[model samples]
Target: MKLVSLNIGKPAELSYKKKTVLSGIKKRPVQTSLYLSNIGFIGDGQADLIHHGGEDKAVCVYALEHYAYWEETFNRPLPPAAFGENVTAAGVLETDVHVGDVFQLGESIVQISQPRQPCFKLAALHHEPKLALLVEETGYTGFYFRVLTEGKVKITSELKRTEIHPAKITISKANTIMNNKNADREDVHMLSQLEELAESWKKPLRIRLQ
Candidate 1:
């Protein structure tokens, strides 16, 4: 897959729902190469660390194809980094990428950890109250990456798959299991046991399986 854009943003206060809140969701594409550390992009910031940034979610990747889908569905234009993804990529979708898949991007190596769970911030950012719900329903919520080899990366870099884990629980499947209230317990248990699945995802599944 090709890395179409590299986006970065810092925390900024914004008026949402008549209240001010700090958010780093409005990222813009960067023209120059940047460092990719274990935590995340060198200049990127996450306002809510509890559900956002960490070793398990260092990079957020969104499929460029989804922008077209959203634009057509919403009847409006959407930018590359509109989803607050660190990498806008082409040729790979959530269904095609498994949770344990590893990829080499420029000089850094990253692994797919889990599907992104849309929150209210998305609706507030786009001014569409149902946007987050639409994303979740469509299962187009992109995915997260955990940095395995820290190095430099650029917008022009290509994403090359280096390894595919044996479990093969795709991000699409994981999203379905998490969002479906009646999801089969056996399936959730199987996915939760994947070593590559993020703790944030497993914790909830474990609770559900109880």
Candidate 2:
């Protein structure tokens, strides 16, 4: 595996409709960078950045990975993503990754914290009526990060697989939580905490449940 691109974007206003209610929301993609600090969350075990409802965050996201790597969608270089990811890696299969998997990028060590879970913001990015349905059909999106060590990383940085586990949660489970309409604020908090468990395991989980 290798890093292909480092991406980031700023927040912008977008419109959404639910029933008879139409609303505009402000959201930003974290600034992507080659270095750790500029990337958002940078720590020894894992790094994190907030993902907007319709955008990607700092660490990892699937984007077009599920769709056979599109060069352009909506006339943009990147497919819809919540926040810009710091590293775009080739040969990093989302489903294949497990908790203990170790990815070596430049001088950095990254572990797969969990599968990426998407939100309503995906509809904003695509402007599609059934964006959520499309995502359910294709599971090649979203990724998580646990930084083992800090170091410089650049576009096209080589991603070496140092370790991986065989048994782990499926990507589908992660999305189930992320996409649940009935999920309350407490549920979201629980999902966030699961990232810690993903750090030490040989294979991180796809979803966090009590």
Candidate 3:
């Protein structure tokens, strides 16, 4: 797949529900190459570390294809990195990506960790209180990556698949189980056992399966 854009942003304050809040969800595309470390992109910032910006959820990746659907649904021209993804990719969707899939991105290596669980920050960033819910319902939520080998990454870099996990559970499947309370118990159990699945995601499933 192609790495369409590399985006980064610093923490900024925004008005949400008549209250000022600090967030780093509004990312802007960067023209130059950037370093990808264990923490995340060199210039990227995440205001809330509790739900984001950990070693397990380092690089957020969103599909460029989903932008069209969102734009049409909202009737607004969304900009690149609208979802606050560090990498905006094309030619790859959730259905095509699985947890544990390894790829060589630029000079670094990364592995798919988990599907992005949308939070209210998305709503605040988009100025639509229901946008976060809409993203979850649409199942277009992007995924995250954990850097396996730190190196430089640029917008011009290509995503070359190096390995695919034996479990082969697609990101879409994982999202369904995570968001759907009535999802099959067997599937939840299976996903929980996946070693590559992020603990943040597995914790809930484990609780549900209990």
Task: List the RMSD of every prediction in angstroms.
Answer: 0.9, 8.1, 0.9
The TM-score values for the models, in the order shown, are 0.98, 0.60, 0.98
TM-score of 1: 0.98
Cα-lDDT of candidate 3: 0.91
Write the residue-wise lDDT of candidate 1 on 111-170 in tens digits. 999899998888988888998999999999999999999999987777899898888888
Residues 1-210, model 2: lDDT tens digits:
555555544444455564321221222333343565423333211112233221112256343354444334434454433333444555666565654466776667766666654455556555665665665656655576667776776554677878754545444444554557455656455455554334322122234333
Off by over 4 Å in 3: none
Tell me which of candidates 1 and 2 scores higher on TM-score. Answer: 1
Question: What's model 3's lDDT at 5?
Answer: 91
Instruction: List pairs with backbone clashes in candidate 3.
Output: none
Position 193, candidate 1: lDDT: 92
